[model samples]
Target: MQVVIGKAITYEQQRLIKIVQKQLSEIDKQHLKELYEVTRIKHEPKDFSINEVKREIECGKDIQSLFQLANTILPQLKISNESIKYYASLVGYYSVYKLK
Candidate 1:
């Protein structure tokens, strides 16, 4: 995940970025690290990202559904309900940054 903080940031976008940074800071990083270490399969999954979904949500696009988004991102691993929900939650967290 490479992030480039460009010189063209708006005040509103910067504010939202701060909010996301704060929300991210409150999360238990170690737990997520452990979870990823345990649950990841050997296969290289699809290439979509939460940022992509956040871009869609920010654009006011009809995202249709989280399950659909999950399938788009994690293709082969949608064998269980929990996996989809988990990925959905992570993706949904970025919804806070959507333009309101």
Candidate 2:
């Protein structure tokens, strides 16, 4: 996306590029958040329950704490750092969303 944005040759093009970038960012965030929710529900972590994580997602307090918990548990499930980071950002973004 950055590469494409950089290719813009006009002022209007740049503005449109920014809008596209912002929209893509929001879409990425939504996908990540959904993935985070699904991952938590699909896997039972020793330190927490699926319902507990769901409740936390609802309240959105300590989203990073949930990220930390995901960081810890993902490795046990043999998930890669890329996946952990993906889910971590998903949880982290949920903090900004503030559904409660």
Maximum-TM-score candidate:
2
lDDT of 1 by residue, 1-100 (tens): 1233453446545765555344433233333333322222222344569866665454333333322433443443323578557744653354332312
lDDT (C-alpha) at residue 51 in model 1: 67
- Structure candidate 2, residue pairs in collision: none
Relative to the true structure, candidate 2 has a C-alpha RMSD (angstroms) of 12.6
Number of clashes in model 1?
0
Clashes of each: 0, 0
Per-candidate TM equals 0.22, 0.24
What candidate 1 gets wrong by more than 4 Å, as runs, is 1-61, 65-78, 95-100
Instruction: Write candidate 2's Cα lDDT for 18-85 as tens digits.
Output: 65355444544554455445434334445578876676566454345455544544444554689657
| Superposition error at 99 for model 2 (Å) | 9.5
C-alpha local distance difference test of each model: 0.41, 0.51
